[model samples]
Target chain A: MESGNLSAGEERFRKFSVYRIVEHLALIACFTVLAMTGLPQKFYSLGISQLIITSLGGIDSVRSIHHVAAAIFTVLALQHIITAFIGVVFLQWEPSMLIAVKDIHDALHNVKYCLGMAGRPAMSGRYNYKEKFVYWFILLGGVQMIATGFILWFPVIAANYLPGQFIPVSKVIHTNDAMLIFLLTAIWHIYDSIFNPEVFPLDKSIFTGMKKTTRT
Target chain B: METVINNKSGRMGVAAYIVCTALLVCFALPGQPSFAASEQGPRKVDKLFGAEGNADEDERNQCLKCHGEKGSIKKFPDGDFISTYVDPQAFTSSVHRSLRCTACHKEFSLQHHPERSFRNKLQYRIKESHVCRDCHKEGTIKSVAVHESLFRKERAGEAVVCTNCHSAHAVTPAVGGNASTGEEKYCLRCHSRETKMDFNDKECISLRVNIAELRNSPHKNMGCSDCHFGFSQENHPQRRFRYEREYRISSAEMCRKCHFDKYSKVSESIHYNMLSTGRLDAPTCIDCHGGHAVSSLGDNRALAVMKCRKCHGEVYDTYAKSVHGKALLNANNKDVPICIDCHSSHSIKNPSSSAFHDYIPEMCGKCHSNPTLMGKYGLSTDVVKTYLSDFHGMTLGLQRKEASKGYRPDPPMAVCTDCHGTHEIAGVLGADVQVLKDKLLKRCQKCHSNATSNFPDAWLSHYKPSLRVAPLVFIAEQFYKIIMPLMVVGLLFQVLLQIWRYLANR
Candidate 1:
């Protein structure tokens, strides 16, 4: 990795490996594809929506495809969680990323700094308050999506235990949660990873776990 | 630890992949074939006088060779064989054998005859029957004059036509006297001036027209004489025409004379009040029962629930898949309310009748509120109770008899027919959610401008003590009897246990 100044007047930048960039992009690609294919069926006109529907053969085929993709995403998410836990407990590579009261202090201090009451920047770690917020949101949205997704995938089985009413409720939850996930990714992930000046153009930490500090 | 974890995870992932792959493969398999193999090839015809390829000449020649056995030995001057058969039995048996065979089979030669094919000429002869007109002009004139004199003057009465009274081959006296009644000859045999009519001209015309029209109508299943009684030539006696110009009498009287069972019931119904008392708008038996093609309701051609839906548009559309609709279609159970049951077939004056207005609850209550009635038919009686308790029903109750009399007093007055169905009164317990969801919205929308998710709750007038046992109410009553007491008892038992423990501890 190329070296960069901690606080720089110099235009120095850190380099990231190709593998980390690809991993994050791959996740974004699949998630976006799934959302685009699934959401329109419930909300939009069947005319144009039918094209995407037939791309997976038919409505039933689309559903099956969606389930398969969801299972793959779920497996990937489980792997990510286990990797995260392992990295935290065994490797102890980034203990600062762990959530703590410091995040609240940092948020307040940042607000103070913005208001010109604070003197300097709070010593931020790899995961800032904003990044941490986005991270937890993905976890919640992902788990909810998977849970409701399974309920819908096998409705007869779900109906056996749940009330007949839960089928439609699950449908609403799955659809809304999916839209929320899509929107959150578009606004939060895309903005931070590619649009944010600090990370501008891309972030590769998902794969390499190497730090990338931009000249500021 | 990392190596062990990686090894285990890798193995697990591979196994999972294999299982998923197998499942996908199973799902991808095509469906089993549904059709059976049909026997192949076209069917063959089996009959004599049938043609094969170039078989016409073979048949003709075979006929000629047998008939011309005498002409086989000697050759003619034209070097063609001539054949003839002079059977001894031919003259006695043949109807036209007095004339020479050459007269009929013109151009008799060894070869096949020309100008007209022998087969064509034979067919023509068979088709024409006979040429009696060719010889008898004055005889025809005398016969015509006799018919004119008897029929035109209305003096003579007989059943005679030329072919009926006379046989051309053996012109002998047919019956040798005045014809017997049950002769069963062609129509001309009795339709002549000599025949006596059982009915006056107008009566006969009306009967004939009505029967003929009915034959062409939907009620074509009925035999002609089914309506007309005492119809025989022996008992033929002319009667005056039965016409009621005041009522402009309906054809239903004819139908009612026989179908008294259904007719009597329909006559007493609310529908009859509208018609009998000059409410010309109401449909009578002929309207739904079918005038010409009167068929039993069980027949495929009979009226369906959708037929009622045509007039009762909104209700029918809503109740398309209601339990009643399904029952009507699936079981053909007329015991379940049809258009007539709820609306009253004959006396169906107006649904707005004040007398019958409050009677709807009791009316619906008859079947719906009755547990035993519902049980026999496997239906939920709760519909009446639920509907009465429902928002629309409550509004209708609020409106009282006034709503039944005039324009729907409440915008969305929930009637029993509105939710459950008019003709079909199936309950919601077994109905699909789609139907339930629609009925819920539609029932509310009848009153509410635009009922949305936040509309006032579906007010079902349930478990009311006033309305009689509609199946729904009966079920509710059962629930009250069994469930309510159990719940109360269970709560009481819990509270007693808690009290006992507390008292003992104290």
Candidate 2:
């Protein structure tokens, strides 16, 4: 399976499959567009925000584009969870994205190591606690956005059965949650996956399908 | 000998040659002709002029060859070109058709034509116009009031040319009416150019009129004297205005003579109220309809809305951002309501008045009541029925009935604009709504001064009470629908019918 391959330059391990890379790329494409089109509407009075809206093709076009991107993201998220579940059940793939007691201990151990209380930091597996946290945060956030977006699109129909206040409340949450998810992607996800000293420069496994071999 | 011939002859002989050459050049110059020849030139000219002159119609027709060509023009460096290309048809058809060319032009001939210099065409025309006095005696010229005014202006150093108004070549017989519009040609001659007149308050107004605009206007069939009364060839009233505004207001008064119906309606308007109260900025007839640029606004009521934009610029901007405004302005959807669609053009009511306040709901209902218009946008036609069921609408309905019967009504009540907005109405969806909670709260505070954030919720913005939205209201309505009717019928039979049976048994 080429799981333990020594590349030309450095020792490498096969990590993300081609399909996994494609999924990541799809998520990135839709997430970037959703953030770009959605955030400006929340801060519409600003010149730069207005510029983005106009550059993206006025409010109507931007809204249509936003809905399309959100639909793509919703489909990708649903498939990601379902595929992970199927792989775990049949193909013996590890559910590494889930949190565990070891991950919690590893976090505490890492804190001790930082303060020089422990001999070394706790060892981790294919997916670390930081990575799992990011995955779960995004997966749940995507669901919330999808539910709220559909409600907003057909508000009158929604209000026929549900409370009308849910529409405005959903609107407010959608605006805020977009900003929250954007910051997580731009800062925490970027830092852990690329800028971290452990994988300084870039992780590159998401693109090249090879991750650095580490000692456990 | 060569030195003497070259030097002395080149000096003293050159001097003598120069003197002789100067004398010959001066005598040859046409502009500064020899005074003796000039005297004889005019005497010859005088002999050829008028009916008694030997120069006949044959001689005039002979000269028409050169004058008939359009290229026969004399250009002055400082001013306009003088066209010597007289229309032969106009001259032959003119009242002076029988006269010779020498009759008016006493200075020209085919052989002895002299080059004359003048500052401008006005000066040239003024000189030629003096010849008119030769045939028409002083008493005859003075008989015409306009002619007397022109003579006075001529004496006062103004360039009042007789040929400027009455063309020398195309001098048609004046119409017999005292002040006929047939004199339009006479007025158009001078007025068509960039003419101006000074008012008493030192305001110089453009007296120029675009003949093309007049020809295209609705008044094209009518004569100039029809509206501009007391002004014509025979009697030009010496009208005076204090300022340009006064002149505009005074000129607009002339429209009332013809359009008395519209004028009377305007007098009942708020604009007229302002005008009478010395608010000079108030628009009169000419302001909206325009003076020379007037055109019919027609059925596209949105086009007429632009006239109000001059004074209500910010209001128009707000309206432009609304759903109705966007439809009317951006897409040219004629079905959408515009400014004058609600506010009558001439009899515009004061919006702040209590009567107008009550009238606004009806005004909005004009279009909103149409199920086709409402359903087109997925808006509910039940809004009118729902609004009528509300507290404000019920009171407003009764108050209107009382007012119809000549009764003084109650205080101001809430209308469509109070909750929805006026120029900024964005349909039922409120597409531009940002923090509608705060907005609704503010609207609620207008009535309930101590209202909190939750106070507006009491109104419960539901078109119809659904179980999900207002369950309490829905339950109460269901109870009313089922129980209230049952109780009413039961009481009629149990109470009234039994009492009638007991009375019969007794």
Candidate 3:
């Protein structure tokens, strides 16, 4: 028995370009605009806000447009989830994405190997445990945003089941979480996936939605 | 190789490529597909026009047919746009009768009318009233004048927009049944979140507050618009509506609105009467109640006391801290003597009113003579009973005019201030010398310049015949206790001596 002949490893694992990074940046820009327009109106406190409200034409109009933008974001999230599930279930790839005890041992080994005490650490196939953790965190944060957002949007219904104080708490969580997600994606996600030395300027996997497999 | 490159396989490859491109496009688009509408053009203008009332041949022949005959009102239900009915008299009298309606209402250019909800893409798209100022450089809207005045008077920002307050089409009344009713309706429109008033996303809520509670107050009955000027029912700007000195209207003008009689009397009275000569010390209504939290003078006990305390702060603070204030607070009795008791509220005459002076002892008498109150402490009611019997009280009771002279400028004549230390009083045994003996001569010396030990006793005013002193009577009792017993013993001794001499001779 023999392993099936594989394509050249370097050729199959092609690096990402700057264009894909720019595209993600444009999407972030649109997301930021949506957040700006929505949050300020949510916390209106004066007459000038009425003018802003009127400029949007009305509250109902702003709400409708805001929901439309949110739907776009939701579609993006669903696509990411479906792609990850497909990668895990159908392809049977990237076993490091699973958080087994061995992954934690390998992570510690990798850190020791980087400090030059060990010659080399256990090398795994694709999707490091840290990246997997970040991906899971994104999914959790997205779900939290949607849940708390709806609660804030319709406080009267929320109050029927939840405590009155939870309304403001939900609002605080929603707003602060939105800020946190923006920060995490900007700092950690962008740095590691695109700007890190290993990637050397960009990663295209998020947009292209496919891995360049080495096996031919 | 020839079989693999056949037309069927080639067509299938092309179809696959096309489907892949389509799927990529769908993925990139994500959601809603939006497109910009056509840009609106400028309006049409008529070459020949005439005054509305006077129709030239062009106006009569070209315009009047569909617009209705010469003087009749034109009721147009349809064209390319919604039919607008223009009154003939209004058009004729208007300043722009020489120009056709199409000149100003630029979008209504077509023969057929547009839908009811059709936005006039031309005229409505032009900038707001400021845009009009571009061409009409010589003219100014009345709102500009009002805005300037508001800025100067209140230092406020523009609250309502120009269009919210004024109409370009016609002179709209401030109130109407179809639109806003008055200032209230206008304010409520934007203030309510339900209404489309707050255009700027300012959270102006229509909090239902009562103005009725402020009636009969000093600020009452003044026009609300006078203070809240430039404030419309529409989306108003958030300005801090303060009652500062610059925005302060004269108290006399405010009071005269309702209290003409009171204003007239006060104007002649010392407060206003003295104010005209540049005496700035005269107190206004604000000085007492303070303009903001002016409560009812009749019912508000705190307000009533605070009013007096404003001018007489030092005296009132001491008075309230005294036993009188404690009694008044505990008992809720008006007879416990507040500031107004000694100095009347409205009719506070000079400090020398016989009713005021005569009532001093009587006012004190209320507490002293109440057996339940004073008797509990074993205190005497004779203070009131004998004060009335004293020469000073009798003099005050009989000849109030002459008794008035006694209370004139001197502390010695036995006014309430004489013994009570005016504001601070203590018990007779307490440290207050005026209440005690130390300062008795000093007070008595005010009227009787040479008063000494021979002067009329100060303690005798309320003196009762208990174990306490009465100079002459106390001396007589001392002599009977000591001297009379010695005299009796001396007489018995003399008798015994004479008897002894008779026995020796026998």
Judged by DockQ cut-offs, the docking class of candidate 2 is incorrect
Candidate 2, residue B18: Cα displacement in angstroms equals: 55
Every model's TM-score: 0.37, 0.54, 0.35
Q: Give RMSD to native, each candidate.
A: 33.8, 27.5, 48.4
Expressed as tens digits, the lDDT of each residue in B86-131 for candidate 2 is: 7766655443555677757878765667789988877788788888
Task: Decide which is better by lDDT, 2 or 3.
Answer: 2
TM-score of chain A of each: 0.75, 0.89, 0.62
Q: Please give the CA lDDT of all the candidate structures.
A: 0.48, 0.67, 0.47
Question: Model 3, B420: alpha-carbon shift in Å?
Answer: 0.5
Rate residue B39 of model 3 by lDDT: 17
Among all windows of 10 consecutive residues in model 3 chain B, the one with the lowest summed lDDT is B36-45
Work out the iRMS of candidate 3.
52.7
The Cα error of candidate 2 at residue B17, in Å, is 60
Q: Against the true two-chain complex, what DockQ does each candidate achieve?
A: 0.01, 0.00, 0.00
Give the poorly placed runs of model 3, Cα more than 4 Å off. Answer: A1-216, B1-173, B177-249, B256-277, B290-293, B297-300, B328-335, B350-385, B395-412, B427-435, B439-442, B445-456, B465-506
Candidate 1 chain B, run of 10 with poorest lDDT: B40-49
Q: Where does candidate 1 stray beyond 4 Å?
A: A1-23, A46-51, A54-56, A111-123, A160-166, A197-211, A214-216, B1-425, B429-506
Ranking by TM-score: 2, 1, 3
